[model samples]
Every structure is written in C-alpha cells, then in structure tokens.
Target: MDTSAAARASVCRLPRSVVTSVHTPVSPVGRHLVLMALCFPSASMCPKGCICQRDPHLHSLNVTCSQSRLKEIPPTLPVDAVLLRLDHNQIGAVPDQAFRGLRVVRELNLSYNAVETLGEGAFIGLEESLQVLDLSHNHITRVHRDVFARLKARVIVDDNPWHCDCALQQAISGMAHNHEAAARVLCRSSDLLDQDGRPFLAVEIDLCNLAKRTTDYAMLVTMFGWFAMVISYVVYYVRQNQEDARRHLEYLKSLPSKPKKPDEADDISTVV
Candidate 1:
C-alpha cells in the first residue's frame, strides 16, 4: 500500500484518546486518523509472498507458512492462529518455545521433514484446544518419556526409527500400554527381537538384567554352583557301575571241578 493509504489504515483502528502530528485536524475522527499514523507508521505492509489479512481456510487456522526452504522456525508467528503445517522442509530441531503465544493451535502437522530430535518438555504449555498431533516421517529416534505428559489430546507418531535400548526402555514400555491414549505407534530397535517372527517389539529383559547383576560376588556364586552339581553326579555314577561288575566275576570262580574225579574212579575199579 502507498504512504497515504497505509497511514489511513493504521490510524482508523486506534482508540479516541491519542493525538496526531501529520495533520492538526480539529474533529475527533481526523484526530484519531492522524494519531494512528504517528504511532504506527508501517502496519499495512505484508511479508513477501504472505498477506497480513485474516485467513479464511480454517476458522481458527489463520496463518500458514509451509513448503518453504526454512532451516529454522520463524520467530514471529500469529499467536491466535490454530492449525500450522510445516511439512516437507529442512527443519532439524524445534525450539521448546517456538509456538510461544499460539494458545489456540489445534492441529499441527510436522511430517515429511528432517526433525532428528525433540527437546524435553517441548510442548509443555500449549493451547488447551490442541487435539491432533502429527509427527510422522521424521528422523526422530526417541521420544522423551515425560515429554507428552501435559498434552491433553491424541498423538500420532509412526514411521520413525525408534531406539529401543536401555535408554529407550521407558518410552517403549509407555507406548505398549498406551491403548487408550497413544494411537498407531511403531518403534523399531536393535535390541528388540521377535521370537515368533511377530511384528511386536520385544525386550531382552533376561539379557539386560543378567548383565546388570554380574558383579564379582554374584559371579563367584554362579561359578561354584555348576561345578558342585555336575562333577558330583558323574563321579558317583561311574563308581557304582564298577562295583557291580567285580561282584559278578567272584561268583563264577566259586564253582567246583567234579567231573575229572568221576573218570579216575572208573579206571581204578577196572584194574582191580
């Protein structure tokens, strides 16, 4: 807008108390017009490729700045705007207070981006009207356990590489039983192996707990247990079998040789 038109637009909305310097008009209407021009000289000029007018798409969704080459989130956003779409961008990390004054934001779509990590308590103090959250197709590895505790809406976090190690045990466990709150979640990890080829993510608790309990004292107890039970059983079994074989040999030697004596008695009777 031109200077004259810009001045008129800014001054037309101010209260009736402030005075003007551009024109010394005596009437109340003229006075308010000049006063607004003096206070805010540049309120009508919109950003490049963006308008300062109210948005008509979503009643609450006023401002939209998507599909841009923005590396970081813009600092100046409309506080009252509700729905925001920041898809298909190169935004790697979001500041905790990026949506500082946006208390009316309801649906947020941050999908198809390069968001690698989320800060803790990132969405701590959000608009109570927020209902749907979409963070799909990002480079996110793990969601902090207590990050979504304050959110009072449904969250969708699928198709991301989730690290299910000890560092991520709490997050995976939380999502497993989130049948009532969290929906359609998928967390993939190296430590999680399915025994029955099922798609369910499994935790190796036995391996985890055993490694944790392997102190010097515990190792000594486990080592001695195997030696005592295994060695004792084998030695006892071999000794019992040897004793039974010796008894059988002695019984066979005790038989007498009486056949040779009968043949000698018959020969002596014939000679007499």
Candidate 2:
C-alpha cells in the first residue's frame, strides 16, 4: 500500500480514547477556563453598569453597583448574588418586592441614596438570608409599620430624615426585637422641636396613645356633627308636616255649608 494509505490505516487501529486525547489536548489555561465556567455559570449575567465577581473562597457572588446613578433597582439581577452594594445612587423609591428575586443576598447596602420611601414588600425575598441592611443617609421620612417588622437583619438607618410621629413610633416599636436597628434610629424632624436631633428610642412621649386620643376626639366630633344634622332634619320634617296639616284644616273651614233641605226645615217647624 502507498504511505498515505498505510498511515491512515495505522491511525484507525488506535483506541478511541487514545485518539481523542491525542487530538484534543487541553492546556492549563484552557482547563482553568473550563473550571471557571463550571463554577460560575451565571457570571456572564452581570447587570449593566454593575461589577460582578465570584468569591472563590466563599463560593458567593458579589454585585457592586454603587455610584452608578441608578434610578431604580436593576430588573435583572443574578439570583446567586450574596452581597449587593447599591449605595450612592439616586433610587428614589423602593416599590413592593423590589428585591424579590434576590433570595440569597445577605448584605445589602442602600445607603446614601435618595430613597424616600420603603414599600412594604421591598425586601420580601431577602427576609431569610439578609443579614445586614445599610439604609443610612437617605431621605426616608416615614415607613409603613410592617416594613421592617419581618426583617431580622442588622439594619443601619442613621442620618435619615425620619419624622418622629405616631406612625414612626409604631414602626419602631414593631421592630423592637431588632434592638440595634431601633436604637440607631434618630429623629431628624418632629412636631415638637425638643424631640428633633434626638434618638427615636430616647423620646419619652407616648405618641401612639396621643394619636389614639386624637383619633377618638375626631370620631366624637364627627359623630356629634352627624347627630346634630339628623336632629335638624327630623325637626324640619315635623314642622313641614304640621304646616301642611294646618293648611288642610283651613281649606275645609273655608268651604260653604250645604243649605238645609226645605223638607228638613218643615219637619223641624212641625216638631216645634
């Protein structure tokens, strides 16, 4: 046989595994790339304007979007992210379930943002895994009573424009178990000037009871007004009915009496 035909026959005689290994040799760099692909399958899904890196030692994904000028939370965040830093942005509000998809996020830094409100379900999915929540230096004036009730994270809410009112008092009281977070709360403004610039927990006034009393007084006033309106309507109705009855009696009196019959008159004279 010719040399080319002999070489092809010799190669075909080799074991399949040996032939495959010989043809596809993997370099160290290639092996490292393959290992990375296996370890971090979702690394390519990093959000725009954010930096995502995998922590090999901890086996976690860290997504950093700080100072990105983000108006709102990214819609598509990797589900494997454990640490999310979104501070120094312009996120005005966190609507319901804003981080609902980030179930594994443990540390969330939302400090130095323009977040004015925290919706009730903003951290719905992170309830179980979230460990630290940094909401310091925001424009948050008030929050719903149950907003921070379900979270067990060490929340940092210092330097916020918190309005020290009954609603805030109720919200803080609900999170009393989170003592660290509750203690860090400070009142940037309040109805009473003395309460301003003081820690929320330090204020001794019973705001909730005062609010209850105010509500009670408002209810009493409203009830009294409604009662007065009902009495006036009843009196007006009775007077109107009486006037109609008097007019009817006057009409009857003005009617001429029927003349007595002649036979009736003659009967009366005979009897006399």
Candidate 3:
C-alpha cells in the first residue's frame, strides 16, 4: 500500500458518529453508503487494506484487518466469513453487537490488542461457529464466565496478568476450560511467588475445588458412620434382651413341682 497508488482516504461522516477513513472516490453520501455496506457485506465492500478470501478449507470466507492502526473493529465484514484475523491493533473495547452478525466465524484472532473488557452479549451469537479464540497479550484481567461457556474452541488466553481467584475458577469450570487458556495464565499477585511459573489450572485452583468436594464427602461419611453406630447399638441391646428372656424361661422350667409328691405322703400319714 504505497502513497501514490493508495486510494485517497476519505472521512465518512455520519449523522452522530464519524466512520473510519477509507479509499473512496465518491460523494459523502456514497461514503456513508460504503460504510453501511460493510456491515454484513461482501468482501469487495471492505475498506482499502482489508484482506478477504473464501474459505478454501471449509468453503466459507476469511477476513483480515490487521495492524492498520485500527482503534476499532471494522464494522463491515462478510457475513459468511469463517476466519477473522484482527491482530496487532489498538481495539480497546468490544461493543455489544460487534460480532453478532458473524455467525459462522470459526478462527478469530484479536491478539495483541488493548481489549480490556468485552461487553455483555459481545459474543452472544458466536457459541456455535467460534472454534479458535485468540485473546493473548491483552489487558484483560477478569472475564465473564459465560463468554466461553458454550464455545468448544482452543482459546488462547496466554500472556495476560490473571488474578487467580473464585471468579476465574468458576468461569473455566466445565466444558469451558480450555487447557491452553489456563496453561499460560500468569499470576498477578506480587506476594504469590510460588505460583509464578505455574499455570492456573495446575495448582491450588483444582485442589481448592477438590478440597471443598472432599470436605463435603467427609461430612457425608461422618453422618453415615454415626447412623451405623446407632443401628449397631440398638441391635446389640435387642439381642441381649432376647438372651435374658430365654434364660428366665429356662430357670422357670427347671424349678420342679415339689408339692406334688408331698400330697401323697400327707395322706399316708393321716391313715396311720
């Protein structure tokens, strides 16, 4: 992209907002139309330097708007694009409907950006098509658990200063736990030197949750043990009472009827 051959960057001004500068040889109304066309549009509708290609592998589309000093995501993108690479930019925040239209994007590379926080529903519609999400080398500390809760992607979240706490532990809990996402999650605490080189998934995080589970299990076992002891004591007492009753019945049977012989002896004495 040289100076002479470069299409003159026109400032597309809208009613309230200012659209980005792109190579356009048309009126302001045409530039506004150009800006509007980028939203869920064709590859030919992208700005000057954006690279677009059809998905040769999956028969979709691929769009790349990388490192053009972009402070924002290019709004106009092909709807059926499967791969969108926007690496090495200054995209600070992701708005709510930024990626809502990209329903089939699989590999999204937003690495080396200034993304601090993603808005609510920022990735709402991407649960199905998103496969590989790269958010490495950014300024993100805490993220919503539902951001990657349903996506089955190889999420790259390395090189960010992560605070290992309960919120993060809950986010990566079930099928959402991407190993690479946890593999390089660096600790942020200065006093936490023991966990410096270790990944967040390997250390006390799993053990911490496991310890909680083990504690619950131990309580359950203790309750069962107490119930068993009470049952055993009741059974022992019942058997002992049964034995005592048997012994009393045997003593009563062994006590002879002594008076029966005494009656005949008395009658004989009276006759004499």
Best by TM-score: 2
After best superposition, candidate 1 residue 209: deviation in angstroms? Answer: 7.2
| Candidate 3 backbone collisions, by pair | 38-76, 39-76, 55-60
Residue-wise C-alpha lDDT for candidate 3, range 1-272, written one tens digit per residue: 22322222222123333333533455656654565454324756565568886543455667888887888877777778888898999988877768878888889999999998877567778888888889899888777655667677788888877766555666667344576566667766422347655667666546446657877999999999999999999999999999999999999999987665887989999999
Residue 84 Cα positional deviation in candidate 2, in Å, after optimal superposition? 1.2
Model 1 deviation from the true structure expressed as Cα RMSD, one decimal place: 15.4
Global lDDT scores for all candidate models? 0.59, 0.83, 0.71
Better of 1 and 3 by TM-score: 3
Over 1-272, each residue of candidate 1 has an lDDT whose tens digit, in order, gives: 23553455453444334323334434556555555444433323322333333443333434445677666666766565566677777889776866677688787777888888787656765737668767778888766765665666556666677654444454444554344433334446545455223222443464345445655558888889989889998988888888777777777777775576876898989888
Q: What is candidate 2's lDDT per residue for 1-272, written digit by digit as tens? A: 23443343343343444334333266545544544555566777888999998775686899999999899989888899999999999999999998877889999999999999899878898888999999999999988888887887888888898999887887787777677888988888985568888999998988888778878999999999999999999999999999999999999999999999999999999999
Per-residue lDDT of 98 in model 3: 83
How far is 112's C-alpha from truth in model 3 (Å)? 1.0
User: Could you tell me the lDDT of residue 217 within candidate 3?
Assistant: 100
The full ranking of all candidates by lDDT, starting with the best, is 2, 3, 1
Residue 272 of model 1: what lDDT? 86
TM-score of each: 0.53, 0.76, 0.55
